[model samples]
Target chain A: MNEVPHLMEHIDFDTTFLVFDLLAVFMFAASGALTAIRKKYDFIGVFMLSFVSGLGGGLIRDAIFIQAGPPKAVTDSKYLLVILGAFVLSLIFHGSMHRLKRTVILVDALGLGAYGVVGAEAALQEGLVPLAAVLVGIFNACGAGLIRDVLIREEPIIFKPGQFYAAAAILGCGIFVGMVELGHADHTLAAILATLTVFLMRILSIYFDWQTRPVLDEDDRS
Target chain B: MNEVPHLMEHIDFDTTFLVFDLLAVFMFAASGALTAIRKKYDFIGVFMLSFVSGLGGGLIRDAIFIQAGPPKAVTDSKYLLVILGAFVLSLIFHGSMHRLKRTVILVDALGLGAYGVVGAEAALQEGLVPLAAVLVGIFNACGAGLIRDVLIREEPIIFKPGQFYAAAAILGCGIFVGMVELGHADHTLAAILATLTVFLMRILSIYFDWQTRPVLDEDDRS
Candidate 1:
């Protein structure tokens, strides 16, 4: 994306970090477009949702967590052009999406990890405390999906008792922040460990059917 | 709240403007708490929603539009303490809320006007374009309610075919920005006209049962 090049002009991002960020954006954009297709929204709505999902995390991160100027997604023109290319491809292949559910979930899991570490690092760069970093990290990882769900008038998976989606993000972000802030680990190593932890937890949770229940169930009254 | 005094020390806000901002926060916080109660959320849930509803607009504006330092709601202790006081008052009087529905609507209309102007001013101060300023203004007026609805597993009123709520906000913000930027009106005059426009629009919409229709209905296929 053009934003990536512009960011490179300003700051020397690590190669691995840049790759992860790009991958996360690509994967989330596909998911967002796919959601719009499923909801039977119009073409404009599809494009809008795709844009929102692709850039929502960074938008929230730059706006709320990092207190940065305009977010990269908004500044770069190529961002939408690239997203448009992907949108066309997604619409073409959407009929096959159900069959590709497994692959989709695997990639989505990786995006979660990428978003988690990216968010935490952004907050820490702004000198936020560990707790705040953790919250921001989770927001970055899942905020897009939440927004998409809200748009479609569905209960967000994060707030409802679905799987351990937000929990996995929380754990991933917590691990990274804790490792960096408390254990004084190196940035790269902490990020790697956090990503791995979240990815594994997400896959295993889906496999084992783990859940984040509400504070109290409807029938759990004493 | 303590944040107000701290802000006063930093910026010599006109007394009328300061009062509007405080009233907006107080009113939104009350609505947030009331929504939580309607959902039968526990005490902690009520408090958390109240805080979110009260602080969400400023948090979003600071994070997204202004790119300022940490938001006042988070930095000032008195923000939450004042919210807590109102939360207690709301819980005590929530039983009669139905009977007081008309009064509640009137206050909320005023809050929307307050938030809309406040948001536009914050964006303009940050040198954003007129379009973005209007968006931020509407977000300021309606963001807290959107967040509250999402948390409660409901579609936000802004997204649904409700009355002209966000329309009112957009008009108010647009008129204010237009007058200040194009007509060279004074800030105080622009702010007053914008607030009155939104307030009147909201109340009239309710009285006239105005609705925002979908682009295409389910049976409107060509």
Candidate 2:
């Protein structure tokens, strides 16, 4: 905290990363809106879900872990605009959302990977320890889904026995940090490789219907 | 953000306030543990609920809105120790929690008010505008219950069709912030008045079973 105000002066992010982050947010908002529609929620619910899906993880990451000035979501107007746009489009095409499920899932994997890298970068830039950065990265990637599930009264994917969702981000972020800190790799290269790993793992898991057993499920049954 | 560093250097809090904050956290943690046990959760569940209930709102406030250093909950190990102590005590007295319901509620009201004031003060300390500090105060008072309910697959009390829970916090926080900012009152006097407001509101609401309706519930039904 003592050093937080000092670090704020040094915060600098490039345009390319910003664009990718916005794209990820847009995709997540769209998915969230579709879920809200499926749940029979009203326009407000649609906006809420969209907002949470788009920025929830980053919200948690920046506020709790980064302790950077106000969360970027609130400080930057662009984030809200992107989320609103997604909510509107999702509602307009609510009837056709079912048809676009595959497309949404495809882009979602990409968004998750991008967010994983972006969140990790924020933490690393904050001078967080490597492990903390990884955890923050995972939070940035999956916290939205967790919050949305709780709101909808369904078990979060991370807590449920499911394919590797958070696990994908965990590996991607861990490797990204490891690469920079241990392997002495370029940031750009590490981000790309880490994102690809998450994207591929997500795609493969979907195709194979890979199942993660609940940690206690086997023991309980036995 | 530019002035944040300067503000940090000037930040100071007294010991009496610190003690009260810890006591509030402990009470909240004890209630969370009871809820976990009632839900048939294991010891880990007890600890998780206790942690979330004890500090979830402060976590959200400090991280998301306050932009202060890492949340006081994390920065201060005493908070964790208090939560752990509550968790252990609750577990040991698990079978008798039901008998202590009336006493717990009485003290819980006190904690809610204390947390409300503490949260508002933190936001105020960070130089949040009056309205924002009030909002943060309400979050501090009841955000834990909302999160815990969501985790347990129950509708949050704030969203339900009964009680003046969040409303109580809102009024108290609003008055506290208003008194300090508009009335030019002393901080200690303002804080005490605000906490008393919350406590009285809670007690009166519970005694009379005061209820608030969902804004849309009546509209849709009508």
Residues A1-222 of candidate 2: C-alpha lDDT, one tens digit per residue: 112234344443366579878998888788777776665555545655677688788788887788768777755668777887998898777665678779878888887888888988899889999898898889988888888787767767688778888888899999899988887776776777898999999999999999888667645866
TM-score of each: 0.61, 0.58
Query: How large is the i-RMS for each model, in angstroms?
Result: 5.8, 6.3
Range of the 10 consecutive residues with the lowest summed lDDT in candidate 2 chain B: B213-222
Q: What is model 2's DockQ versus the real complex?
A: 0.14
lDDT of 1 at B75: 43
Please write out the lDDT profile of model 1 over residues B1-222, one tens digit for every residue.
112333245544456665676777787888888776665555545655676687788788877567678665544445555666777877787766678889889988987887888888878888999888888998999898887877777767788888999999999999988987887776667777898999999999999998899978888876
